[model samples]
Target: MNHVISVINQKGGVGKTTSTINLGCAFANLGQKILIIDLDPQGNASTGVGIENNERENSIYKLLIERNNLQQYVKHTKIENLDIMCANVELSGFETEVAEDKNRAFILKGIMDELRQKNQYNQILIDCPPSLSLLTVMALVASNSVIVPLQTEFFALEGLTQLLKTINRIKMSLNKMLEVEGIVLTMFDKRNKLCAQVEQEARKFFGEQVYETLIPRNIRISEAPSHGLPVIVYDKYCAGSIAYEKLAAEIIEKQKKFNFAA
Candidate 1:
């Protein structure tokens, strides 16, 4: 079955886009066909995967606004199994543009339903904006589950509480099947006692909902996007790359268990 997951964290600078890109790359490396939907107005996920700004004329904004064929918007990345529906700054206006529509939240869901019929990808990751806005809501409504990238720092848990409430609210009213796939601890530093504290707290609260893989703060991960590549592609042996690869494997294993149970 094809899985549609939203990589989201309302808090900014929490490695949301980074996790989205690298995780998709890792899944591709594992021979899974992956499609990353760049829903963020920043379009960082698109840039991270090497989609140029000039090449984003038929972006997610057009797809959302025009309700066009999804295939027309999907752009293949340099990686063999990875593709992306690019986004641009114009996506920032989507919320306002659809304010009066009662079914606005289901728009992305409609497109996703079409994608599901094609069965072209093993995984589809939606890179959401850093806010609990209309765009984020659309992503949540469209996705089967979410992968939250939690930064190991102060106020991280506080922000997570609000995000959880939002998820529950949407679950009750919109997407009944929506679930949290896993929480990834990002930007971790072993030397930082605070990072350890946060991880402990997260594991205590979320239990198995938190993945074992920890994405460390690495220069290679930081440099990859500028080079228009994922860290695993940029520096495969790096700590960050290895961590994301492990995360991909972990997610795949979890999916197998879920499928078996189902």
Candidate 2:
């Protein structure tokens, strides 16, 4: 079965892109076919996986507003099992280009459904931008579920409330099946008392919605992207890589439970 998961966090610097790249690689390391969609205009996810800016002529922008062919856009990354559909600054103007379309949100969903039916990928991970605009709405409509990364910073919980409201509103109006897969805490500094407090409060409120895995603040995780590799591949023994591997395993286990129930 294929699953499309949007790695979203409207708030920036929450480790959304980092999680998307490494988690996808983690699954790939398990021998699963994965496609990573870089939906952000920043193109960090694309570059993180070694897709250069000059090589994005046939990126997601073309796939969305121009050519709707996956083969024309999908590009291979350094990882054997992971492929990517990139994005660039042109994506920022997409909203204005489709302003007259009544069903703009469904554009991405339609394209994703085609890829889903082909069953080429076991997992499709979308790295969304840091805003709840039409792009994020489109991602939510296209995804089976979303995985949010919450940074252990002050006022993190306050921002989560607003994001949840947006998710609920999207569910009410767009995709009713849109579900939250889980939330992971990022940049957790155990030496900091405030980080511990944030984790405790988050667990108290979110409970089972929060994953048991915690991505600690690690220099290797940040350095891997500069070298255009996932942390798991850049340095497999790093804390970030270990946590993401655990996250992928947990996600697979959850899928088993979901399949059994179905």
Candidate 3:
């Protein structure tokens, strides 16, 4: 069964794109056929996976507006098991376009359902925009699980509360199977007292929802998008790459338990 997961955060700087791209790559490295869907207009996940947004012909925008088939939008990545549904600036209008559609919230879910029935991927990782807009609602409706990438900062926690509330609302109203897969702490700097304090407080509140692996603030991760490559491919030995691999394992282990229960 394909496990569809979304990396979501209402806060912009929380590393949602970074986590989605790297964790998708890491899962591919473990021999899973992974599809990374760039649901953000910024399309950082597209660039992170080496898909040039400037060259996109059919993007997630088309998928949302035209109900484009998932196969038509999939672009191959340099990584073996990783493919991407690229997004571009055109996606900025997607929310407005779908705003009035009665089934707008399930647009993405409908596309993904068709793809899942086709059985083309082992995992689907969606990179949600940093908001509770229609796009995020669509992604949440499409996904079975959500991994919230949070920054170990004061405001990040507050944003997380709002995101969790939105997820709860979605679960109650749309996708009943939706669940919090895990929380990943990102942009962490061990040398900073603020980072430590924030992480401790997050653990106190989120507890088991937080992943064991913490992504440190690493320049390599920030630089990789400029080169249109995931941090793992840009610098395999980097701290950010290592953290994502650990996170991938954590996710896979949880999925394994779920599969056994099923």
Candidate 3: C-alpha lDDT: 0.87
RMSD, model 1, all Cα superposed?
1.3
Runs of candidate 3 exceeding 4 Å displacement: 258-262
Off by over 4 Å in 2: 259-262
Model 2 deviation from the true structure expressed as Cα RMSD, one decimal place: 1.4
lDDT for 89 (candidate 2): 94
Rate residue 231 of model 1 by lDDT: 93
TM-score of each: 0.98, 0.97, 0.96
Model 1: how far residue 170 lies from native, Å: 0.9
Candidate No. with top TM-score: 1
- lDDT by residue (tens digit), candidate 2, 1-262: 5688999989888999999999999999999999999999999999999988999999898888864567889998989999999999999999999999998999999988999888899999999999999899899998888899999888899989889888888888888877878889999998999999999999999998888989999999999999999999999999989999999898888767765111
lDDT of each: 0.92, 0.90, 0.87
**Angstrom error at residue 104, model 2:** 0.2
Give the candidates in order of lDDT, highest first: 1, 2, 3
CA shift of 124, model 1, Å: 0.5
**True lDDT of residue 208, candidate 2:** 84
Top candidate by lDDT: 1
Better of 1 and 3 by TM-score: 1
Look at candidate 3 and tell me the lDDT of residue 259: 59
